[model samples]
Each structure stands twice: as C-alpha cells, then as structure tokens.
Target: MSPVLRAPLGRVMRWHRPLMLMVASMLLLVVVSVAGLAFDDRVLLGAPVWLKPFKFAVSMAVYGTTLAWMLSLPHRGRRWTSGLATVFAVAGFVDTAIVAIQAARGTFSHFNKSTASAERVMQVIFGNGVLCIMLANLALAIILAVQRVHADRAMSRAIHTGLGLAVLGMALGFLIPAQGTAQTALTTGGERVLLSSGHSVGVPDGGPGLPLTQWSTTGGDLRIPHFVGLHGLQFMLIAALLLAALAARHPLLRDDRLRARLIGVAATSYTGLIALLIWQALRAQPLIRPDALTLAAAALLAALTTLAAVAVLKAGRVSDGNPPAAQQANLDGGRVG
Candidate 1:
C-alpha cells in the first residue's frame, strides 16, 4: 500500500497488543482444529467433535479483534477501561480453552453435566469464565456509550450501537441454558442422572439441524438469537464502512450527519431483528420454518425500517441548510464542529 493509504489504515487498525495476541492464539487453535477435523472421525452432539472448538476459536478471534480496535478508538478513559479489556481477554481465552479441552475429550462443552466431579468442576470454571467475559463486555459497552470515542459522526454511532447490541446478544446466551427442555437419563450403574438443559426447545439437542451451522431445523434453537445478537456489532460496523465507501460516488452521502442518520436507521432495524429472532426462538419455531405470525412480525419490521430509511434520506434532501448555533452545539454532546 502507498504511504497515504497505509497511514489512514494504521489509524483505523490501532490494536491493543494483549488482545491481538489472544486473537493470534485463537488463529493457531483454528489451524489445529482443522487438522483434528481431517483426522478425527469422532462425532458428538450430532457433529464432529472438533467442530465446536473450531467454531469457538474463530468466534473468539473475531470478537477479540473487534474489541481491541474499539478500545483503541477512545482517546480518553484508557486508564480505567484497560483493566476491563484485560479481564475480557483472560476470560475469553479461558472459555475457549475449556471448549477445546472438552472437544478433545469427545464430550459436550456446553450444557454438559455428566454427574462426575471432574465434569462438574470444569463446567463451573467454564461458566464463570463466560460470565466474566459477559460482564467485562458490558462494562466496555457502558463506557463506550458515555464516551465520545470517535470523531466521525457515522462511525461513532456505529461503534457505540454495535457494542450495545453485541452486549445484548451475549446476554441472550443465558436464555439458551435457562429455557432449554429438561430430560432425565439412567446411568449404567442404575444411578438417576439429570443432564443440563439442552439448546433446542421442543426437541432434543442432537436432532435434525442445519448443515455447518447446526442450528435446529425441526424446532426452536435459542442459539439463533444469541449468535445473531453477538455479531450485530460487526454487522453494523461493516454497514457504516460500506456507507462511507459510497461517499465517493454519491455526493449526498458525503455529509456526515446524513450518514449518521442512516446509521440510526440501521441500528433500529438491527435491534428489531434481534427481537424478532428471540420471539421466534421462544415460540419454539425453527428459524427457517417461521410460522405466519413470525413472518408477519418480520415483514412489519422490514417495512418499518425501509420507511425510516426513506424518511431519513428524504429529510436530508429537503434540509440542506446548516443548523443554528445552538443545534450545532447540541450535536454529539456539543462536541460537533
């Protein structure tokens, strides 16, 4: 890349070193997981034993990288927030490591309560790590919500809203364990065993599932909302970047306020999508087989979002004048130029 391009990219890519290292370790795990997939024929929970570890490693890498970049965006509050970042890094790694370990043992990583002391202890540790990561991310989200982390209006909105949605998505994970169907089994020694609640509602966990993703196809899967919500931050950030890239071809999008308003629309739509997924999951409806009511709700959300986008663009076209001094001062908590 040319110096001009490299300079700008460097500004955008500023990363927290520890988090980057965590991401690197996850990438290495990804490679190891792939090799496991190629050689190991073991299957657990209706999928290859290695699949869970591979998926988790990839998720950890993406989430850690996004978080590191977000932490870099803030010019202030670095001192206090740094501790939270470290907490997240440690917790995320521990959580992923436990998953990998369980995969190697050819057992379920999550929702596993095998009635063995070792299994129970491992689950406790893994659960605590996940909780720590969630709490740390929540702290980061609160900090970003209050801090003026970015100068660009659109980018600022995107970052703040994305983190908030991601936090919500992480929270949704709790529902997976809480709302799953409970079942009882008998051990070979004639001991009664109660397994942890599984992920699929109205169906067993190891039932028919979508390929690759393994989302439940025959019944509701709580992971759907959890997965979608967790990645909403990345989706919104990508949407904002795509809008910025269109500025060169579309003169109107060059205005930061206009772009920011469009981002607001996107954020609302994304939030609604999360809500819809949760509703669908709660109803014990498969994601790919939504009922009429679910479809109606989805259609309503889409129509509302489209109308909001059109309204924002129309308003932008109609009002090209600069705002009054008072209004200008109010923008971005009175920090707008």
Candidate 2:
C-alpha cells in the first residue's frame, strides 16, 4: 500500500484491541462458514445451513470494526468507553459463536425450541448474548453523543448520527420475535411448551426468499430494516469520508459547515428510508414488492432530501475563493439595506 494509505491504516490498527480481535475472529469464521457452504450441502430453512453463520459472522465483524474505530476516536471517558467496548466485543463473539455452533450441529440457532434441550439452551445463550451487546452498544452510543470525538464537524456528526441509527436498528430486532405467531408443541419429555416465533411475517419461515439474505420474497421480513439500520453507522461514516475526499476538487465542499449540512441531509434521508422499510414490513409487504403507497412515500422522501441538500448548498458560504461581486455585496448589505 502507498505511504499515504498505510499511515491511516496503521492508526486504524491501533483501535481497541478486544474489538479488533473480535473482528479478526469473525473474519476467520466468515472464511470457515464459506467453506462449509461449499462442502456441506446441508440445508436449513430452505437455505444453506452455513449461510446463517456466514451472515452473522459478517455482521458481527462489521459491528466490531465500527465500534473499534469509534472507541479509537479522541473523546472523554476513555475508561468507560474501553470497558463497554470490551463487553460488546465479548457479547458479539458469543452471539456469533452460538450461531456457528448450532449450524455445525445441524440445528436451528435462533428461536430454536426443538425437542433437544441443547438447542433450547443455545437459543437462550444467543438471546442473552444479543441483549448484552445491545445494552453495551447503547451505552457506547451515549458516550459518543455526549463527548467531542472529532474536530471536523462533518465527521463528528456522522459518527453520532450513525451510532444513534445503529442503536435503533438493533432495537428493531426485538420486533421480529414479538410479531410472529406463537404455538404450542410437545417437548421430548412429553411436556408442552410454546415455541417463540419466526422471522417471516404473514407467512411461514423458510419460504421463498431472496438468494443470500433469505428475506422472504412472498411476505414481510423485518430483517430488511433491521439490517439497514444496523449498518447506518458504516454508511454515514462512508458518506462523510467521501464528502471529505470530494472537498479536494469541489470548492463548495471545502466549507466544513456545508459538508456537515450535507451529512445531516443524508442522515435524515437514510432514517426516512429505514422508517419506510419498517412500515412496509409491518404491513406484511415484501421489500421487493412495495405497493403504490410505499413508492409514493419513497418518492416524497427523495424529493424532500434533494430540496434540503440544494437549500444547504445555496445557503453555504464559499470558503475556498472569492465570491462574485453581486453576491459579495448582497452578503455585505444583507439586512442593512
């Protein structure tokens, strides 16, 4: 890699050790899961058994990497941030490990109430593990919001907004188990127990789904919004980074306030999209099959976002060079004329 790139990469490498290790482990598991997919033809829920493991590994890896970078930022409460980050790392690892273990055992990992007590135990562990991660993440988000991390306004706004959206996304997962139908089943000991629920809405799980995501193609899949929400932090951070890069060529973007305002617009639009996806899923509509109402809502959101972005740019000051004489006079004579 070039020296310019290696310097930033090295800084990233120095992020919270536990979180980075968690990310590394997840990446290794991702490779193993892919190998399982290639060799093991076993199917679960109408998809490759290892697919869940792969997805969880990837998700956890991303989660860890983002968290690690966040913890690396110069902010107040280093002790608190580090402790919470460690907890999050452990919880995420345990969560992903449970999925991989259950997949290796050829049994359901999530919402598993199978006759086998082991599967039930694993499910309980997974639930608690996820809950722990969420709580730790919530605490970290609070810390980031309360403290000054980045000197650049645009990047700082992205970090804070991203963390907020990510917390909401993680919370959305709770809605999944809440919405599915409950049913009674007999255990191995002839005792009746209620199996929690599944991911699909308005239809049974394991139905026709999008290829790798396995999101139901025929009915609502809450995972759609949940997934999008969880990654909001990564997306927004990337957007801010891209805008920073564009500042080199674009004179308007050279203004930090303009870039921050643009990030705000992007964050608002992203949140709206998440809300639209959740609404569609709640209505038992498949993501790929949004109805007219959904389309209209989406168009409105896009138009509003475009307008807001344009307004921000128009109002933003030119930081890189002199403005036109007419514009300069208007700026100087504004409200005084």
Candidate 3:
C-alpha cells in the first residue's frame, strides 16, 4: 500500500481496533450516549430518553471485558480469575438484556411514567445493575494491582491509586438519587400533573441521579456522571501503557526502537484521549449550556494531538544505549580483564 493510504488505514484501524477491546467498547458506549442525547425525545423507554439505559448496558459490557482481561494476566490463579471473569460477564449480559427489553417496550422513559410500585422496582433494579458493574471493575483493578506489587511495584501502585479513586467516584454516584422535582410533584397530587401514577411514577426528588456527585445537576440527566465514571477506563489503560513504556526503558527492551515506538504511540494517544475526556467533563457545566462542552472537546483534541507528537519523538531515541543481550553476556562471562 502507498504510505498515504497506509497512514489513513492505520488510523481507522486504531480507532476501531480491539487492541484493547474494553477501551473500544467504551468508545462505542460514548457514541451511543451522544446519540441518546441527540434523540432524547424519541422515547426508547417510558423514561424521557433511550440512551441512558443503553449507556449503562454498554458500560457493563466494557467493564466486563476489562475484568476478564485483568484476570487473565499472568500470576493470577486460574480458578479465581475465571470465576471473577464469569461474574462480570454474567452481570454485563444481564444488564444488557434488561436495557434491551426496556428499550423494546418503549419503557426507557418508564422511570418518568412509572407508578409507585413500578418506579420502586425500576430504581432497585437499576441501582443493583450499576453496583454490579462498578464492583466488578474494581475487583479486576485490585487483582491487577496486587499481582503487579511484587513484579512491577511502581506500576502496581499507580494503577491501584487510580482504580481506588475510580471506585470511590462510582460509589459516590450511587448515593445520589435519580429523582426530579417534576417527577415528585407529579407523584404527590400537584398541578404539574405531567403523568398520573397509573401512567408514570416519575423520579422522586433526591432519588438516584448520576453516579458522580460533582456531575449532578438540578434538572439535568446523569450523562456527566456516567461520562466521568467510564473515563476511569482511560486512566487505567494509560497507566498500563505507561508501565509498558517504563518496562521498555529496562535493558531488556530499550534497544528495540520499534517496541519503544509502539509503546510511545500507545501511551501518547491514550494520554491525549484522557485530556480530551477531562476537557469534556469540565465543559459539561451543569450551570451552563452544552455548546461549551462541544467547543472544549474540539480544542482539547487539537492540543492533545500536538503534544502526543512531541512525546512520541522523544520516546524513539532510546536506541542510543547499551543492549540487554550484550550486557547480560558480559556479566555471565566475567572477563574483567
């Protein structure tokens, strides 16, 4: 292939590549999320939108894959690893099925229109689904961290800390209720009778909102929190790439310019992506409009691309050093003279 075609093809592959299936899955989830927002009025469920439940289901799948991959890493026991992987997979499958069913029945907005009994049930089910996915992801991260402690202590520490923060953020989200005042007013005998109890149960005030406390808005949906929580995957994956970069610095791989280059690209791309996510979150000002978020995302992407170029160039210069094989052979032969 010509270099021009090759380059564009490579970029396409990178975007769609399952090089990290979990990350790829999350990207898909993000797309779904954007679509949900765009078509909020379509009513996939009785809820006011179609995308939220789908987003959650996608999250479960992404996290499930992460959990499974983490467990399969070397040094972890086969049995426990398999069991945990199974748990995550099963939970993800269940959540996906639930969301699909609700979506089919046009009940995605069901929360907005459910009666008291139906509303309670939906809340309980949704809450449990969230917990299942979060805990599964946390468990996988912990396992990876523990395994790395003895072999790659620095990497382990970084991953552990990042994962801990992610878990904390996700847990905080659970504490916030999804209820809205409008929903509550509709429920209690009030003038804003958007839907009767027979039609929809409406989310009560202080019900579960988004998962992250900082992202919640007075009348906004949980997209911001969902975005924040899911972005943890980016952090963990970047940490993994950074660890790989650090590993490449060891005499074992440093002389191999190609390996270093690959790691460099992976790390730089992920780091840029992380910055973009942060920018997106910041722009999603609950106090402001969504246009700010769009502009911030664009600007951050441009800036990140420039920075990544510089970082990759620097990483490629590691070949000007001692090779691992020569050093090892010299040590083994012990010909000091």
Candidate 4:
C-alpha cells in the first residue's frame, strides 16, 4: 500500500495499539452472540439470554480500545501504565469468559449461587476480580485527568472527560452489588443466591422489553445509564477524531480552542443524558414508557445541548498561526496528514 493511502486507514486502527487478544476475543464474542441468538434455548431477563455475555464482550472491546488509544497517544507513561492495561484486558477476558461459560452451562453468572456451591464460589471470585478491574479503570482515569496531553488540546479534553465519565459508569456497577436480586426471591430451589443482582428493580426479571436491548419495558433498569455512561470515552474520542479528520480536509476545525470547547460541550451534554437515564430509571420508569415529566426533561436537555454547541461553533475562528501551535494542531492544519 502506498504511504498516501495507508495513513488515513492505518492510523485509525494501528494508533495506540490496542490489545490484540481482546480485539480477537471481541470478534469471537460478536459471532457467538449472533449464533446464540439462533441456537441457544436459554432465556434470562426476558432477552435472548446470550445477550448478557454479548453485551459484556462488546463493552470490553470499547473499554480496551479506548484506554489503549488514550495511553498510546502519549509518547511515554509511568511504568505501571502497561501493567494496568494488562489488568484491564485480563479482567475483561475473564468477565466475558465467565459469562459465556455460564451461559453455555445453562446458568446465571452474576447472581447464581442457587446452582452449586462451586458455582457460587466461582461467581464470588469473579465478582471480586471485576471490582479490581474497576479500580484499575479509576486509577487510569485519575492519571488521564492529571496528565496534560500538550500535543492536542481537543483530544486532551476528550480523553480527560471521557475517562472521567467512564469511571462514573464503571462505578455504577456498585449498585448491582449493593442490591440483591429481585428475581432470586421466587426460586425456592437449592441454596438461593443471597448476594445476586439482576436488571429489574420494581418488577421481577424476564418481562416484555425493548427489541435488542431488553431494557425492561416494565420497570427500573439501572443498566441503561450504566451502559450509556460506560461508552462516554468512545463517544467523545470519536467526536474529537472526527473533528480532526474533517479539519484536515477543511482546516476550519484546526481552531484548537474551538475544538476543545466543542468536545467539552459534548462531554457536558453526554453527562446530562446519562443523568436523565439514571433519574428515569430510579423513578422506576421504563425507557419506552416515559411520562410527561420525562418528555419535558428530555426536550429541555436537547434544547440546551444544541444551544451550547451552536455557541461554541460561533466562537470558532480559523488559526492564522499567530502563536506557534502544537504539533497536533499543525497536523490538523495540514502539515502532517
């Protein structure tokens, strides 16, 4: 491939060098998710049942790539940064492995102490490992927050905001561990799982839900905000990258301050959306069954986000190289494509 053709496509995939194993595993999981949809007889929480594992796999992919990109953007890092990435990758793998393995075994992994003592012990061990991964994520977020990506201000803000919000999302998992399973109450079988927690809050698990998400059309489901917030890093980083790509073609986006503000606006609005989801869920409102209050809040948030974005765009100005810009800005200005 010519250097001209390779830079655009190759840079996106190869930059920051993501965990190859995690990437490969995610590909396999996506296939398994589809296959299970066709073949698996299991049903959990009113979904296709393999859905949990599939979702977890996809989430891990996003988490791994986002962090990998963030860490790689920098020229150097602390000695432990590499170790943290490995922890995240391993934990993600174990997470998906447990979910898929249990799914194949015809059992629940999260709140499934009801099956056998061995399974119960394994679940507890896995759960602890998950907590450790969350801590690793928190540490990464802290590092990102403090470190200045002097190379690219827009990307810097995006990384900081994304990592911060992602930590919030990851931390939300605490809710699951804190609240015991609402569905486990009815099963009068062997050794009921006391510490288990599922999606549903007001109603029991396995009811009518939205098409793919199975996000509980009936009652409160914490997973909604949790899911959205967890992807915050991806969301903002993509936006920043898109802006840079566009700016390369249309140098208007080379305005570093403007790009940074636009990213900031996006991060703020994204947080608001996540907050809305959490509020709606905590009130036991289904995603599809939003009441007047929900509609009003949603409308207000949309209007505010749009207005803020417009304001940032208006503030944008083309750079005239008054002051020497960072290497990234120059690259955005077409010095390096």
lDDT of 3 by residue, 1-337 (tens): 9998999656544431232344445556556656765675543212334455556656555555444444444556555545555555555555555665455444432334454576457656765766775786577566665655323443344445555555655664543332223333332222232322211112233333344232334334333443555556556556555545765565533333433344444444544554443433333333233466556765766676567655554554443444478886887788764
- What's model 4's overall lDDT? 0.76
Candidate 1 residues 208-272, lDDT tens each?
Answer: 89987789999898898899889988998898899999988987798888999999999999999
Q: All candidates' TM-scores?
A: 0.89, 0.89, 0.49, 0.83
In candidate 3, position 44 carries an lDDT of 23
Residues forming the 10-long window of minimal summed lDDT in candidate 3: 193-202
Segments of candidate 4 deviating more than 4 angstroms? 1-18, 177-181, 185-195, 246-252, 317-337
TM-score result, candidate 1: 0.89
Specify the highest-lDDT model's number.
2
On the 0 to 100 scale, the lDDT of residue 163 in model 3 is: 58
Candidate 3 ranges with C-alpha deviation above 4 Å: 1-41, 44-48, 108-113, 116-119, 149-162, 178-226, 242-337
* lDDT-better candidate, 1 vs 4: 1
Clashing pairs in 1: none
For model 2 the local lDDT of residue 35 reads 100
- Cα deviation at 104, candidate 4, in Å, is 0.7
The whole-model lDDT of each prediction reads 0.84, 0.87, 0.48, 0.76
lDDT of 4 by residue, 1-337 (tens): 8999888767666644436568678879979888997897666544566887888887787777667666666634655676777777787787788888877765677766466777877787788778878888888777667777647789889988988888888887777545425455322123344435676667666777887778888898888888888889899989988988888886657877788888998999999999899888878889889999999999999999999988776656423444446765876779555
Winner on lDDT between 3 and 4 is: 4
Give lDDT tens digits, candidate 2, residues 1-337. Answer: 9999999989988999999999999999999999999999877657888999999999989878888887777899999989999999998988899888877766667776776777767787889988998898899889888766898889999999999999989999999999876555342234454567878789877789998999999999899999999999999999999999999998789778789889999999999999999889888899889899999999999999999998888777533357878888998999687
lDDT of 3: 0.48
